[model samples]
Target: MASMELTDGYDEECFRTIVLAGSPQELRERRIACQSILLEQLNVIPIEEWMFRVNTMHDLIAETAVLICEAQMKEAGYGPPPCTYSFIVFGSSGRQEATLWSDQDNGLIVEGEPDGEKNRYFEFFGIMLSDLLEEVGYEKCAGKVMCSQGMWRKTLSEWKEQLKEWRTQLEWEPIRYLIISSDMRHVAGSTELSALWQKAFYEGFIDNEELSVAVLRNTVRHKATLNLLGQVLTERFGDYAGGFDIKYGVYIPLVNIVRRLSLLHRIRASSTLERIEELERLHKYQHLDDIQRAFLLAMRMRVNTPFSVQNGLLISSDYIAESELKNKQLLSELRESLLLVRRLHRALQRQLRSAERWRT
Candidate 1:
């Protein structure tokens, strides 16, 4: 398909005109049309610019979903949300790094107590919003992280208490939740609620050594994709045999390391690139330019392919057919990127260890 011409630039007005121009059903259809334009334009735009475009498209979809939920609530006589709430997205969407077929990972933070009536109201709207999002193309999160889930949709005090529990427990599951919650960004509704949630989360890590160690442990849990022989590892078995798990094997480790360091540095930026830039500005890390370039290259590769959900997890293939892998130049670039990931991982580990020593 020929790429869409970008004459007027990507703005909210253009987004509304294209994706929100018609009836509810028609709006859902138009949202997919907008995605098609974005996918096509992905081929021509710079990787960074393309990522921004994708995020904007996601924001538009979420806003439209919120509108749908509002309409539904009005029809049911709920009369909009009872209390101020922030629709917060986590994972890639939260970091403004969504790929072409990203699934939803979001939740809600409402002001005041989670009374029975108010809880029911938000719960109904949450399910409505998730359903609308799925209809428009974004898949529901497999982890049940969406606002439709009771565990995710909570009052501000409830969320603060939850964070405290996670910090106190410091178990594997709780630590995992803490890390995931770290990436949340406010998509709609009250920004104050979102800020309060963030404050609670960041404060949990302040001068907390045990929490820092838990984060470090989780951050290094995954092994790099490159083996000791420096060969890129492919899936040994499965439908994706001979294909690389780029999402987990490369992108995730980089994200984890950057996120951990960002938290340690008290930088609140969620995007991996943004965290790296902040670390560089703080003179905290060395050779950030190369690391950023490699990270961007990996992102470009992942976004170039269509994403799929398998076993309820979002997966993308990095499979270069053996025939294609025989192309010396292409092979070299792929190997170089994988090696850079390994190098960056090692560098991050060293920095963390050094920080631990300094802390003592």
Candidate 2:
């Protein structure tokens, strides 16, 4: 990314090979190879560096895939892209926190009017790219956040209007979209367009006093990971019964609390760690060390959660195993993290209450 000077088991050569991959199949093979290498060094590398490596690999694969897709489009008679476009990602991929098994959460932002010709061309391009990525081991997003959907593949102007529509509603569904919008990151093409898309999103945010509260209302809808007695909550029943829902329980609650605080403090960052750092700088979040500590642990546990290798793809589950839960060190760290999450959760509740009173 910044430079190809990676060290300590992060194979710069493998990463370069991914960039040089000739076909989607080549990329897929390279990705599988890279995944093997990373898994072997999973515990050896720190989560921070591991995350950097994995997500950077994702960026390169996606970028190279874009190049291949563009050439294919030309060969298939579509000519060039017709206009500048940005390939953007959402959720963990957007925040640069993708684990080894993260799925696709992406969109295409085109640089022109919503004309029939451009739309038709990019629609084909979108489906091709999505299919290629799936072939490269990324499962399509279940919610259809991928660019194959017209709702996600839009002209820049159309995207702005969509943002406005989401902001205006402030309902649960629209609020969720607004939160997702905050995580958008430009992976390929037209970084300038990507910057503008994000700028418009936040610029509107600066004026919408009610928007943050609406976001807060939505942010607090997380599943609780800790009980009143400061106990770690595990799944009561299911395939993962007795195992902790590391994703929803610990990771997401922490993410949501920090995200809401970031919005309130005008901290414009997609990465949750970056948001926490800025909030600390602003003195908006005092529990900085704890937050970072717990967050890293949460990420580590999330990545370490049970995963299966099926079809050369790392299929990850969001829950830690009940057996793994017995690790004394892990339990200790998790309890501390959940406690901080609980504290931040209460803090967010207070902010929402105050906002509601202000409205009253």
Candidate 3:
């Protein structure tokens, strides 16, 4: 395997050399090689360090891919982009919490009028960028959240309008999209665009009682993976039978709680740990340090385990083998983590109820 040691600072040229050296046919293989090298080092690093490094690496890959796509478009006789644009990533990548395997959950925020010509320019740009990312091993999001989709590729004004609709309507799907968009972080292009959108988003939900309740209701829908018997809840059927889904069961509830708290507090930090720290700094919640510790433990378990993936998307199995569960220490840690999640969920529910009562 090639040396996986990252250079001391951002090395744009080095990334370009690696990415641009390969032909389209070989791009996927090269990307996998780079990812494998990076993955090899993740096991030994602290979870926080691993997240930061991997996020930085992925950012480099995105920048390089955009540059390559620009060249490809120019060669294909397309003119330069009509206006400034920002590429925003959401979900785990946006939160800087991506595991070794991830799919693209991204969108485009173009600064231009809502005109057909401008829309077409961005449309083409989104497609090229999405294609380049796929060639480099980032699978298209199953949710169709990629910028290549019309709904996700939009002008700044369009995004604002969409946010308005999402906030005002309070429908399930729109609210869900709004929650996901809350994680948006600009990875490339005009950095200010995402900030503007986020400002609008925060302002939209800050004093909206209805929206807050709806968000809380949606967030608490995912039950903790631990059953009443204090045993890890394993899948009863499917290919992953006997394996628990750590992603949805443990990681996502924590994420949802952190996200809702950040919204409630009007905190802008995107990562779960950062949000927790910010909440702590404000003395907003009790046992935050313990919560943070539990979250990191969960993250470590996530990175250390080999997950099953299908079509390049992680299959949600933070699967602990039955044998590993039989080990007292391992089982104890797992139960403790799940218990923490349950406690946190209840605390959040109490907070929500308090806020709702105050509103009433």
Candidate 4:
């Protein structure tokens, strides 16, 4: 986690400067400046280092937002937090796999029982944090999974109860929520509360074959990126016309595959690479090395996808442009990656079917 803090010029002192910025406009500019530095190093460095650098800038920006939000509340007469609570991030941020243009996938896990004062305080905090994040440039989650939502902002005990109810449902939407929560990681506030929340979540898998299979069914369903003739499938029309969806087409499919297998084995690691390593350590999968290589490519190629700079912030369609895909060598690499994803994707579908059959 320490590595998530500083990267070259972005040290602790640099973050302090951001925290101490005179106004929101200054804060946003400082963040943009940092991201510009990352943009400069993109193709120049190893994909792994570039990814690390990108996430590092995101972390600093988020932490600075947290500090500023608290100060803003105090200045507005909220005092310190009424109780112990945590600011937790979900999805890409939680997994430490966020790209430069990542959205707000976060929540609040407050201590103690759910009540009026605590709820109101965190609601205000959530709004401020989300606005601050957007001001410096992370888009709000289109799905409304952010902390500002009443569903996501809850007391620690309330979260456990919700998890329990979701676990018992064994239906599509609840299972989806369960899967989403699987990626939860504490970004700020009390680590103990976060741990307690995780303990509730990960423990739900034990003796829960029906629930696991439900998740597996969701995992196996992915967009086909290659045709039967082994040609790459590009977006046929619209703004992203003829562009390859490196995100869902390759990266997310691969992430789902790794996440499914890890959860099946009861491995609780969140990030794709970490789950692969953990699975490898336990001798869980035969094609993990190939999966790792393909996933790393997906990560790089996803970041390499076309983005436009508006207001000095990246706005991406998450598509690898048709013009860029015309390069024979790059197309060949993409085909190779998609082929692996396709193979493993079919393999997992077969596994899911087999598991269902045996259950009957």
Candidate 5:
């Protein structure tokens, strides 16, 4: 029988080398290798420990992948392409809150003619980068909304036109498009691209007669969660177990509402929590009281609960039964805040309907 030799501290040294000190290209390769190692070790460790290891590995890997792609472009003599391009990450990645299964949602913006070949080059780069990511275990976006997808990859001029059309039209499809576009954040590429487009789009869209209506109409798409009498229909999957799909149900709604408000006020912040804080400082929207703020905080906390797949899957959260919340006063405050948000949603729906009538 062959005896296995003990390799003391080998794993720790490997983890540090891969996640922290390596150059961009080396980090990318090492991180991918670390993921494979963690996956193989999953059966030997407890689920909770495995979750921590995998998530840490993933965070480092994602950052490394981005860096490596940038390095590749620089090495190709493109040297960051142009000063007027931006890599905008949308959806979960934009929020910096990703689960193991989350796919990519990203776009690219280059300041150039809409129909030119430069735009094609940006698309080509994005496609190649996304293909590499897929090979590293980060699956490509299923809806074809990634930067590699023509629908998302565009020149700055093209995006501005798209935004203009959506704002002017005030139709369902246009509104839906804007909703996704609104949540975008500049993750990489030309730094000023995001700010420039944001300035133009906000100036053109906010408080516009047609655009406001479009946004309000889009807000009501979450109506299925609102029961006949206007109660929030909590999901059965986690409610009985003292949990909820905070991601889809509560967090998404909060984010959507913030999206509408930010668009209305032309708030430039991307994340919901940041938008709330920024709006509070602006002092224009005083509807969010301390109680409401606390509620939003609680909801945000619930939304950030971590999860991972070990054997089958493991999801964990700060979610507790309505009766089990430790801070009763805090919970009470949050509940009130949630009601305020509900009212806001209703008011927006009414505004949209009125606008529709006026337009007709």
Candidate 6:
């Protein structure tokens, strides 16, 4: 009986051992578990506790989720064959700033034999992978903009065709796709897939005189979060009792504006910071550098905070309060970033109008 009791205690200790393990792999696994738990529990946590807890959890879960997708792909026979493929993540997931639950936004690029079977297999694998992700935690995209959706699943030729068609339309929805697709990052699978897409898109679309104008128009849909007096804007609901949607209210605008500019020039870098650098190299907007730096810092700050968890629960980032900005540096930087985004919006609006005239 004593031996049995001791053995049970050892088993319990073994389970806890992962959390305390010094190895990177062990800590990574533990982080994944902890992140999943935090995401599951974010609704109940107070806003003050957000920074450390929320951001950490978001990072862990994002990587873990991607890991799961890769494994599922192998199981589905979509693993790359000698050649290369890229499991591109788009939108929030692509940015690596995803909260507890974000919809599927992804694309694929493949460079393999034109064997119809291989293309079909890749599409089948992506669908299964997206479905598995939904089961694990992520919600299916309402518009079906997931790997599981037929529209989003495509071969290299199909993708090029779709892009050309969308460009020809130059409509609001297509413009939106162009912006979101700019955030893509190769998470796993064949790296070649992303490379091919990047090469093709940058070379084909950036210089397309007609498509550039449409994208610019789509970029400036919102105004600054602060009014002329410099007071932050409030909405009808959320934290601050009535505050703005930080994700959409601030971050997305910055992301969208930068993306439009980058895509217009075909910069080919997905990360915002990298995009900013690329823009600088192109000498497109010199005065905007400070603002770009501030915005990138704000995004880092927000993603590093726990508000994402709570925001995920509410299905919105607006509930995040300015009062939660306990760190003065982060708060100041975030505010500056928003202002920069606002400036960029105005600039984009003007550019779009010019582009429209030029097109005509």
- Find the candidate with the highest TM-score and give its number: 2
lDDT of 2 by residue, 149-226 (tens): 988999999999999999999899988988987888889999999989988888778868888789989987768777
List clashing residue pairs in candidate 3. none
For TM-score, candidate 1 versus 6, the one ahead is 1
Better of 4 and 6 by TM-score: 4
Off by over 4 Å in 1: 1-7, 10-14, 18-24, 306-324, 347-360
- The window of 10 residues in a row where model 5 has the poorest summed lDDT is 1-10
Q: After superposition, how far is residue 77 of candidate 6 from its true place, in Å?
A: 10
Question: Model 3 segments beyond 4 Å from truth?
Answer: 1-30, 307-318, 350-360
lDDT against true structure, model 1? 0.77
Could you give candidate 3's per-residue lDDT for residues 268-293 as a string of tens digits? 88889889978998885787787788
| Clashes by residue pair, model 2 | none
Flag clash pairs in model 5. 85-190, 295-334
What is the Cα-based lDDT of residue 58 in candidate 4?
71
Ranking by TM-score: 2, 4, 3, 1, 6, 5
**Clashes per candidate, residues 3 or more apart or on different chains:** 0, 0, 0, 0, 2, 7
Off by over 4 Å in 5: 1-64, 70-84, 95-101, 114-120, 135-137, 223-243, 290-306, 310-338, 357-360
Give the distance in Å from residue 35's predicted Cα in candidate 1 to where it truly belongs: 1.9
lDDT of each: 0.77, 0.87, 0.77, 0.83, 0.62, 0.60
Pick out the ten consecutive residues of candidate 6 with the lowest summed lDDT: 1-10
TM-score winner between 5 and 6, please give it.
6
* TM-score of each predicted structure versus truth: 0.89, 0.96, 0.89, 0.95, 0.68, 0.71
Candidate 1 TM-score over all chains jointly: 0.89
Best prediction by lDDT? 2
Per-residue lDDT value at 64 in model 3: 65
